[model samples]
Target: MEVATSNPAEETNVWGGGTRPLNASYGKLMMWFFIVSDALTFSGFLVSYGFSRFKNIDSWPIADEVFTHFPFLHGIDAPMYYVALMTFILIFSSVTMVLAVDAGHHMQKGKVTFYMFLTIIGGAVFVGSQAWEWKNFIKGEYGALETKGGQILQFVDQTTGKRVALADIATPIATDRETHLGSNGVWYVSETELPSVSVAEVKAGFEANENVVIRIQKLDENGHKTVLSRAESLEKINAATTVVEGANLIHNEYGNRLFADFFFFITGFHGFHVFSGVIINLIIFFNIIVGTYEKRGHYEMVEKVGLYWHFVDLVWVFVFTFFYLV
Candidate 1:
C-alpha cells in the first residue's frame, strides 16, 4: 500500500510552530510577550494600592492636597496641573512614536529621524518632571507632627482655611541636641538628618499662634481633613512626640505612610520603564540615522520599539488616574 505524502507547507501550517503567528516576526512576538507580563505586574501593584486606599479611606491623603504643585509657581495651589501636563507630554510622545513607525514603514528616513527625536525629548522631559515632583514630595512643604499613636497632625490657619508651613508656624528654640552619628553613638548606628524644626519648637509656635489649629488625618463629612477647635487643638498637640517633615519609607507627613510607599514604588517603576524606553528609542534612532534598517530594506525595528512606547504611555494613563485623579 502506498502512503499519502504530506506537503511541507501543509505540515508546517498544521503544526503551527515554524511560521510567524499573526504575521508578527519573532522579535515582535517576544516584545508582545514582555508587554503582557509587564502589564500584569503593574496591575498587581495598582490592585494592592486600591485595596490599601479602600481600607484606610478616611485617613488616606487626598490626591489634590498632596499633588498641589506647579513648576515656577511656588506657593500656588495648582492641584494636578503639573501632573496633567506630564500625562499630556507622555501621550504626545506616544503619538510621535507612531509617526516615526509610520515614516519608517514608508521608507522616509528624514521623517522617521525627526519623529524619533521628538519622542526621545518627550520621554526625557517626563522623567525630569517626575524627579522634580519627587523632590517636592520628599522635601515637603508643610511639616507635620507625629503622635505616639502614629497619627499625623497638620497645622492649618483657621482664618485662611489653608495649611501652614512649619517655617511660618515654628518658633525657633535653642537646642543642644545634634544628629546621632556612628562615631559618636553606637558603633553601627546612625540617625537620619534631623527635621528642620523640633517638636518643642512646633509646640511653642502652635501655642503662640491662635489662628492656627490642628488638622487630623481623618476626613470630615465634606471630604476635608478634620480641623480641631482651639481647645481640641491644644489637647491634641500634647500627644505629638516627633516632628515629621517629609515622606520616607519610615514616615510620611502626607497622612498614611502607605500612600507615600505606593506612590514611590508605582511611579518610580513607571518612570524606570519610561527611562528604558527612551534609551531603546535612542538606539533605534541612531541606527536609522546610520541607514542600518535602510540596508535591511525594512523599519521593523522602529515598529517594535513603537509597540513598547505605546505600552509605556498607556500604562502611565492608568497610573495617572489612580494616583492623581482617583
Candidate 2:
C-alpha cells in the first residue's frame, strides 16, 4: 500500500481547494442562478407598479395615509412601523441561516440545529404579521361618500386636518332612500343596502357643515395635493356633483381603484413567496433534526436554502423603501 503519511500543504490544497473562476460549489452556483431569475421577477412587478403610480401621479393614494397602523397601539398614527418590523424579522432570519451554514461547514450539528430553529421562528412571525396588515387594509377605515363623478370627497376639519367619517359629518336622515332592491320602480333583479352615505346627502352636508372642506385628487407643482377652503370647496363640489354619474377611473374617493389593485398584487406576491420559503425551510429543518445531513457528510442543503432566504430579505428591503418610504 502507499505511504499513509502526507505533507500538510498537500492535504490543505486537496481539501481546501484554492479559489477558481466560478469557484462556487454546485449548490452555491444553483443558488446564484435562482437568485438572478427571482430578482428579475421582482423587478418586473415593481416596474409595473411604478408604471401605474406614474399614470395616476395626480391622484394616487399616499402610502403613509393608507398603511399607518401598529399593533397594540390602536389609532396611533404610526405609519410603516408594522411593515418595517416585518422587514427586520426577515432580515434577522437571513442572519440566522448564514450562521447555520457556517456551523455546518465545521460539522457542528448542534449549532446548526439551534440556528435553524431560530430561522424558522423568524419566518413564522413575519408571515403572521403580513396577514394582520392585509386584514386592516381590506377593511378600510373612515369610509367616505362616493360621488357620482367618481371622485372621493373626504370631510376634513378646517382646524385639525384629520378625516371625519361620513356619518359624523352628515345629518341624521329620517328615512334613507338608498335601497339595493327595486321596491316600487322598474325592477327585475334584487338590490341591497346602499353605501352608508350618498352623493345627495354629501352635497347637503357640504352646505350645512361650515368647518368641512374638500381635497380633490388633482396634483400641485410639488406633486402633492391641494385642499380647498370650506366656501370654495362647496362651490366646486356643487358644480361637479350636478353632471356626475356612476364612478369611473377618473373619479372615485379612493383615488383610482388601481391603487388598491397594485397594492394587493405587489404585496400579495411578496407574501406568497415568503409563505413558500417558510414551507421549504420547514422541510429542511426536519431533515436536519433527523440527521439527513449528518449521514450525507455535507451541509450543502442548508447553504442552498440560506441563499434563497437572503434573497427574499433583499427584495423586501427595496419594497419597503419604494412602497412605504419614498
Candidate 3:
C-alpha cells in the first residue's frame, strides 16, 4: 500500500483545482466580477447626477410632479404610485429567481421551471411599464414657452394655483403654418414635427385669459416655481421666441434640460440591462425546459443566471431611490 497526500494550493489561485476561489465556481466567480464592474459604472453615473442636481437643486423638477401618470387612469395625479408598483414587480421577480435557484439545488425541474416562468413574466411587465413611463415623459402633459435664451415658462391658473395644459388654455389661430421639413430645407438637417400649440396662439390665449400666470423655471424657497405677477407675466411673455410642447434632447417643459438628459441616459441604460437580463432568462428557461441542465448532473447554470438577475434588481433599488425617492 502507498500513502497519498493532497497538494496544497492557495484558494486565490483561480486556476487551482484543490480549492474553489471565493468558494465559487468558475461561472459564478465570473458573474461576480461582472457585477462589481457594472456596479462601479452605475455608481459613477449616480455620483455625476448628484453633483449636477446639487448645483441646480432649487430648479430641479420635483419627482412627484414629473412622474404622476398611471397605467389607465388618465388625468389622475397618482404620483410615485406606478413606479412603486414597478419596483415591487422587480423585487418579486428577484424572489422568484431565488426560489428557482433553490429548486435547481434540489433537482426539482418542475419547480424550477415554474419559478423561472414567473420571473420571466415579472421582467416582461417591468420592461413594458418602463416603456410606458418613457412615452408619457416624452409626450408630456402641458406645453411651455421657450425664450430666446432657452428658458422654459409654463402656464398656471393664478386663482387655482394649478398648472394648466396648453390645450386647455391655447386659443386656436387662423393661419396657414408651413412646417419645416428636412427634404424641403437643407438635406442634411431636419426639424421635428410641429407642436400642438403655436406661439401666436399661446400668446393670444394668455392675453385674453385674466386667470393665467407665467411660471418661470426658477424655483422659489418653497420649491415651487416662481410665479410672475400680472405685470411681470406680461413682460416675460413678450420674450417668448418659440413653442416647446414636450421634452427632447434640447428642451424640457419640466424644468432643467439636464434633468431630462440624465433621465433618458441613465434610465435608458438600466432599461437596456433589464432587457438583456430578460433575454438571457428566456434562453436559460428554454434550456431548462429541454432537460439540458437535468442531464448535466447539476443546475449550476440556473444559479449563475440567478446571480445576474439579483444584481439587476439590486441596481434598480439604488436607481429608484435616486430618481424617485430622493
The candidate that wins on lDDT is: 1
| Tens digits of per-residue lDDT for model 2, 1-326 | 12234666756575554433465776688789989999999999898889988887878777787788899999789988888889889999999999999999998999999999999899889989988887777656665544455566556788888876666666655565656567656687554435566666667776788888887666688866668887788776764442122223332344566766766777788888888888989999899999999998988899889888888888889888878887
| Model 1 poorest ten-residue lDDT run | 1-10
In model 3, which regions exceed 4 Å deviation? 1-17
The superposed Cα distance between candidate 2 and the true structure at residue 26, in angstroms, equals 3.6
How many pairs of residues collide in each model? 0, 9, 0
List TM-scores for all candidates, in order.
0.94, 0.81, 0.94
Enumerate residue pairs that collide in model 1.
none
lDDT scores in order: 0.92, 0.76, 0.89
Residue range 1-326, candidate 3, lDDT tens digits? 01222554544564655654365677788899999999999999988999899998888888998899998899999999999999999999999999999999999999999999999999999999999999999988888998988788899999999998888888999888877888897887777677887999999999999999999978898887899997899889999988877788889888788899999988988999999999999999999999999999788899999998999999899999999999
Best by the TM-score measure: 1
Ranking by TM-score: 1, 3, 2
Q: Candidate 1, which segments miss by more than 4 Å at Cα?
A: 1-13, 16-18
Candidate 2 off by > 4 Å: 1-21, 147-149, 174-194, 236-254
Q: Global CA lDDT of candidate 3, please? A: 0.89
| Per-residue lDDT value at 231 in model 1 | 95
